[model samples]
Target chain A: MSHVNGLPKKSPDMNGNVTITDCGDSALVAKAVGLDAEAAWRLVHALADALDAVRLTGGHDVVPTYDALLVEFDCTSTDHATVRSVLAHEAARLGPHPEPITPPRHFVVPVVYGGEYGPDLPEVAAQLGLSEGEVVELHSGSDLTVRCLGAPAGAPMTDGPPFPKPVPRLASPRTRVDPGSVAAAGRQAVICPMPSPGGWPLLGRTPVRILDLHSDPITAYQPGDTFRFRPITPQQWDEYADLSLADLVDSAGLANSADLVDHHG
Target chain B: MADTLTIRTAGIVTVQDLGRVGRSRYGLPANGAADQHSARVANVLCGNDERAPLLEITALDFACVPSSDILIAVTGAPADVTVEGGVRPQWEPVPVRAGETVKVSGIRQGLRVYLAVLGSFEADRLQGSCAPDTILGFGPALSTGDELVLRTACPPLDHPFSRIPLFRLKAPVPPFPTSWTIDVTDGPDRAEFGDTGRRLFDAPFTVTPRSNHIGLRLQGEVPRRVTKGEVLSRGVPIGAVEVPAGDELLVLHRGRGVTAGYPVLAVVTATGLSALGQVRPGQTISFRHRTLDQAVAAHRAQRNAIDALRSRVRTAFDALRIRAPAGT
Candidate 1:
């Protein structure tokens, strides 16, 4: 992923109960700092609690900033002034962020690159002036972490190394992208959970159904969960195709190869 | 028995009360009526709690046979209602005889209709909600031959509105005017767009065929980049209007993906969100900008109106002296 310059600190003159930062467009962002994860959680929970206490009816939302919590309330039930007031007070009460959100955990999403599974693999490789296998190596060899799930909830954003040349998104999104299609846009790697229209450059696909709406936990990634990638050949994909859902579940264990490095198990 | 509205034909219907709460952590969409205001109004007319269980009908006919005579109200888009093949009224509460068939024709204007039985339907509430998010396999949509059980006996009206007979008097909920002129407020990422993007707020866009509960894909001048770089994908509220491809405007709705990567320009006000629900593919839409104060005022006004209606119903019910039917 292209490294962000990091959050620009608010200028002294702009300080207020809620100093708005010009993030872009006509809208402005309200920024606050939490000392640690607990503090962050408290800031998040307090605002949520207040929103709930007001009986504002809407779904709860979450995002991936370590030091901050993102809240969206029904504009009809509450205004930005009140919401900002509640959040800033809550954040100030909690303090600043701790170092241990630990830069998210890494995961190696095993993918079968090229052929029919990856419609854009050849195109991306050609653009990079590298062979398809080289493209796979470049992608799978790098370290990655779950940033946030976008578009589809549970669709994880994992960082990848810089492309040999930038791969642009499809000019026109396919009406339905196959589930498990490994796609890249900018420096982010995404695994499609369900068939959806997407612009990312498709590289390969995984056999794993990573998202289960009915699953108790729902999403596998936490803010700190890490991610890595491993390449599987198309033949391996074919072999797994005959397997039942149970067989696929069994295969997840076997897919863990000796090449895997464990910073933490 | 309480009041049972038997299904003759279920019409794309579902048993919805207030939606499941405290469950977004599990990735559940707060599935309920797209227009919560109308749903609450229907409930109030039927002498039920504002968020009581009701039938959410989508684009088709729904016929129900009431088990016990009770008051009922229909709200949302105006639809042709017939009882025993005779036209019925909208808005004001009316009594239906036991076993009488109530039929609502396919939406002539709006997409959904709310049917509140005097007493709500009884279902095992999952996480304090009867509204089902089918993605989670919570339950199936209401279909023909599905028997719904009402939990309490109907409270008899000493003088039912059926006399003044609010029948045939349909409250015309103005149909979504001209392809839905949705109101929006600037969001955190609105700054990501370039100056040209600011000009986009001045015009209207047409809804593309790709639009759905997930999002409204609008065809227009995609906003220019403000960040000149990428921003991390993050949590977005329903009705968050994002322009991802940099050409088309994507206005998220109730069923939008739980998260998103694209830059969001603004979020639509809650009062306008129901209008989004009625927006069909190929419809035209315009963006109206409002300050945060305007949004908050609109929100509070809607909430206050809903709460006011609720209290008024309570007062009316309290004065009626309707006894609990039989064995408690």
Candidate 2:
């Protein structure tokens, strides 16, 4: 109930811009209405900064998705009112524009293209009216930044590379997609770190284990991290099966890592 | 001393603790015991810390054999716990000699059973938690013949009052009800459904057998559903009542993903999570609407009550010179 920028605290219903609503008793979601996903993403960072300034930080507790930010806290300690107040106060404090939260790290995962590594690769190439090699050229050709980490546990979802057209998903999702299966749907490409059900079209598979319980650095990539795929042969894929994310990043060489992008579109 | 417990039979078994908190940003769900209160009760009765590693056995036959003398507590869905072929009580500590076979089966009234050993239970850890995340293939699932090593064996039970376990003297167990009417709060997308989402509380929804720790899929009147690819992907909560574009209404549990794309119309309150976790498949569940403030108050009350029970148990253990770390 302390003063926030000399304004009396507003209830959950009074937030001007952000639609701050209760996700549950323990979590709150502030989604920016009438804003594009990018603008919403910026608002998420602003709210995160606003929360951090007030000593509310649990690095992993604040989940910033494509547009909205879901903030979770212990209901026993931090009540719902305080969280909403902070969001409204910060929104009022910083009017108009907020800076983007760009991911600072980059990783190039070695993947085996086509065949069993990704069953949809051939069809993806055929549907796009491009040759198989051209498909690989288009798929592994761009540096895609992660939109967010979601669902299948640490699978990084990113905007798809410049395929001639927005790639289509399967008519019905497969019951299971093998772990390390790299998939594409519409304009997004993602890596399925575990065997789970999915409808995305598979382009290839990465031998580099992105997320593992027993390994150090369980999940190396975060939102905004630059994620790129480097096509490797089936043998190279086999070699990468046991390697960790650290191993791939280290071997890819940090200096030349920035040169991996071609902007094929 | 590296003593181990061998899993004799595994039926949907895993190891869990309080769960990995604040790790959702890394795309990890705070996967833990489906029923948090029962897990803590089991650990408290066994003279171990609430966050100590323990076994989470779902509805199915589960048995284990200890390699050393240890005290264990079995709590959750009422179950027949047999130590060395003899029945042992649930919700209190029971001692088992080295090489004794402990069996937990016929789990009735609930879905999960917690088995907490008296000392430090060891397992491969991630983010300082031993809880398994099956969706991510994160922790080892308990398999028959899998040996679970205990870093600290049970303390010598030769104290003057060792004739009777001191920790067993005080264990406050709350009611475990078969009929459930869980409390839920309006979610961010509740306005999207408006009148349609009211069907969630219209009647009792049957928990379909398709349910698991990932989510409790209920077969009921489907509200105006949001197609799978409709909403932007966002982080979902432990007890989120997600409305998918399907015949079933899904209520997410602890084992759910950190982020999902389905639109959530309402979220079950924390006060209702334990009951949601313990209900058996095919059981009817109804939702009661509560304001966010009321929901928070109920959570604090439940937590405060658990803290009181923990302190009392710790005091009794101290009388026997037994160490029970303060519950956080």
The candidates score, on chain A by TM-score, as follows 0.66, 0.76
What local lDDT does model 2 show for residue B268? Answer: 88
Q: Which ten residues in a row have the lowest lDDT in candidate 1 chain A?
A: A9-18
Candidate 1 is scored at a TM of 0.77
Give the TM-score of candidate 2 (chain A): 0.76
lDDT of 1 by residue, A38-74 (tens): 3443334344444445443332443333222345444
lDDT tens readout by residue for model 2, A1-265: 4434443323345465577767888888877766666566667757765776676532237777777778888788776666677777787676545754432467888888889988998889888999989988877887787777787787888877888777876877787999889988776789998898787889888887777566544777766567678988897766777887655553443454444222210
Task: Please state the error at residue A66 of candidate 1 in Å.
Answer: 8.1
Q: Which model scores highest in TM-score?
A: 2
Model 2 interface DockQ:
0.59
Q: Candidate 2: misplaced stretches above 4 Å? A: A1-17, A33-36, A49-60, A89-103, A108-141, A161-171, A212-216, A229-265, B1-6, B65-69, B97-101, B151-178, B226-229, B325-328
Residue-wise lDDT of candidate 1 within B130-226, one digit each (tens)?
A: 7765544455787777778776656545243434453333333435564667777766566677575575577778888776556778887667666
Task: Please tell me what DockQ candidate 1 reaches.
Answer: 0.22
